[model samples]
Target: EFLFSSLVETSTAAELAEKLRADVSPYWAVHYRFGKSAANLSATALAASSLDALLINVAAPLRYAYLRQQGTEDYRERSIEFLCGIKPENNRLVRAFGKSLQPVDASESQALIQLYREYCERRKCFFCRWGYRFLSLSAR
Candidate 1:
């Protein structure tokens, strides 16, 4: 928590990445507590996948949301730039969506998940902009 708080206060994405690797690694090494079966982990013990997961799932979303809420276009663009610059995630949903719609990075994958959960799963096609437009055209 201390590492993340310090990391989050940084003014730029590069700083955040640096703090995550440098500061967070030591914190994880000393205080990281996983299940009993898992071995005690050091800074070097953490995998790229774990850090990528944090970047994708937590940092990007929060940054984008805060920028959007504040109505700042430049910061929003920065948030997106940070997201698109990250490595792509490979999971079942990303793979499934990739068959038809390839997600170039973690941001697109997150967008697909949001679309599926918020629109597709709820059957809210009428409320979707593309779906509403398609329906209007079909009716015309």
Candidate 2:
């Protein structure tokens, strides 16, 4: 309920993180204990955990579901925009790509991620935009 509500209300990644921290952290402390976990954790730690859950468990699946249902170029673009708006920094894949380059704005980062997901990870480089360009240059 909270996760769905947060997604509906928040537009940006930072906003989602903040909302998770504010609204979910208290309940998280009580219900989210792991084996032998500390009885008390700082607010920061709880907030981080909540943010991770929202991004990974909630947002990512929702984004993919939207893409599967819509199945159009425009919808794909919108899904990417929605994912990018949600704190790409919190995502390990995005962070790794950021380190490889000097910096990447949200759109560039999302594009790279999309490319990776759709082509690179699938070993479909021949069909990838960058791969196609590289292959064409090599052929020349």
- How far is each candidate from the true structure, as Cα RMSD in Å? 5.8, 5.6
C-alpha displacement of 94 in model 2, angstroms?
Answer: 5.1
| lDDT score for residue 4 of model 2 | 72
- Per-residue lDDT for 24-100 in model 1, tens only? 55445555465333255545554677777888788876776766777876876677677776667777756654466
Q: Show where candidate 2 strays beyond 4 Å.
A: 1-3, 22-44, 47-53, 60-81, 89-110, 135-140
Count steric clashes of candidate 1. Answer: 0
Work out the TM-score per prediction: 0.59, 0.49
lDDT of predicted model 2: 0.59
lDDT of 2 by residue, 1-140 (tens): 57776664455566766665654455555454644445665453545645655664577567557657656556555555565654334466556444544223445555667777888689897988776776788898
For all candidates, what are the clash counts?
A: 0, 2
Residue pairs in steric clash, candidate 1?
Answer: none
Tell me how far the alpha carbon of residue 135 in candidate 2 is from the true structure, in angstroms, after superposition. Answer: 4.7
